[model samples]
Target: MEQISTDVAIIGAGPAGMFAVFECGMLKMSCVLIDALDELGGQCVALYPEKPIYDIPAHPAIEGAALIAQLEQQIAPFGCVKLLGRQVTGLAGEAGNFTLTTSMGDKISAKAVVLAAGAGAFGPNRPPLDGLSAYEASGAVRYYVKRREDLRGKRVVIAGGGDSAVDWALALQGVAAHIAVVHRRPKFRAAPESTAQLDALAAEGKVEMVIPYQLHALHGQDGVLQAVEVVDLDGAPRKLETDVLLPFFGLATELGPIAEWGLDLAQHHVTVTPATMETSISGIFAVGDIASYPGKLKLILQGFAEAAMAAHAIYGLVNPGMALHFEHSTTKGVPG
Candidate 1:
């Protein structure tokens, strides 16, 4: 078993977790970050790299990938140990001394732990259809868009009514030879601006809106999609011929082994003290969407604030009885 030690161990590489690294580093604390994804940015990169985000403090608008890149740059000075593509299998010990085991048979010993995993481990909610696995193996169906070029010049059918579905429908307009959007309702769950763009594209006859219908079946040869069978509210079937199908039914979240860590859980989220972002177990903190408290806003900015609190609190555990001389980044500058 591989063993490592740090002042703090953060269990996510999302915006909040990355910011935690910066915060801890600012206080002269060393940290190690672990994430299940091969890369950082968590859901931002995995779910919607091209998705635009507003309401971030400084920037009025920023794409998901851009925001992640910026966060990565912000934390680069910290030089925290990054253990990517690993899941925490077991957590042992207590405050001031914790042992975390990963699926890769690696062990991390840290003075404090921070749970910044956003929505925990998430996977796309696969649409229910017979032979769906077979079609998926053939590459005709996908849960998310990894490459825009793959959809270029292809007949694509986007399924679902959420932001991801409509956003991709608008994004793929010029790239796809023909596009169709299938949803159970005409109403979209996407942002108004994105929905408007999709609406405009449909009005321009660039894309087809197959509304009030649910995916009934998929017909294809060896994973090459020929047509998609959908059922309308009236139970009438319609066949849409397409080469590819993109389903954006959202994600199914699971905390997995973390749920068994004996922390106070509210639904799928771990409950933390709003004052210090600490969990029931001392030295173990929770932040981001996976962390919850009264009046907790599930925003990136909120998580950022929580990370700061968790980092400061963790500083105490890492260096017992040591008074922290707080200094602004402008005054001290980021330590090299």
Candidate 2:
């Protein structure tokens, strides 16, 4: 096993983790960024590369892939070591001196650790349908729409009653030939404004709302989707012919090896100090969606703030007695 050392070991290459590199770099700290995915940007690049995000500060609107590209560029000057396509399976030692073991048989030693894992090791909650894997392999069934253009002119059957389901329905309005939303309840869990927009589209005959229904079975042969079978609460079955099935039942997230690292956890999220974003264990911090505290908002922008706090707090641990005279970005420009 190869051994590496750094001032801070950052897990997860998502938006928060990527930003943490810049924050730490600005403080003259070195970082080693690690993630399970082969690529950076986490779900932004992997799931909805084409999806437009509106809440990010500065830019009024930016697509997922574009946002990640900008973050990558922002952190490029940091020269942080990136360990992709591997997971950190073991964490040992204490504050100021920690050791980590990855699944690829590599060991990392760091003075501090930051966990920016957004919904650590996340995957879609696939419906329990027969031959689901076959259709998934052939792109007949998909959990995430990586690119909207892939579904152009195709009939789509969307399942679930969350923001993802409603948002995607609205996003694919002009792109898809036809769209039918399947939900187990009439009331959606999405934002009120988005739900209202979907209702307006449905009333205008641009979308179909199949409420109080759940996915029953998939009708297809050789991984080619032909129709989707849905049933109501009373067991009434209905078949909707479609070329694709997009199930947005949310993600099945697991902390995996992170759970055994002796950190305080609440509802599968790492409980952290609100001010410093530090976990129960010293030298280890948790931020982003995988972090939880009182009145914590699961927003990317909020995670960015947390990453800054964690980096600032970690400066003391990494530098011992040295004081971190904080300077505004205007005064302390990024490394050239």
RMSD of each: 1.7, 1.0
Q: Which 10 residues in a row give candidate 1 its minimum summed lDDT?
A: 46-55
- Candidate 2 lDDT (Cα, whole model)? 0.94
User: What local distance difference test score does each model get?
Assistant: 0.90, 0.94
Model 1 lDDT at residue 275 = 89
Put down candidate 1 lDDT per residue, 281-319, tens digits, no spaces.
899999999998999998999999999999888887989
Best model per TM-score: 2
Q: TM-score of predicted model 2?
A: 0.98
Candidate 1 displacement at residue 175 in angstroms: 2.0
Off by over 4 Å in 1: none
TM-score of each: 0.94, 0.98
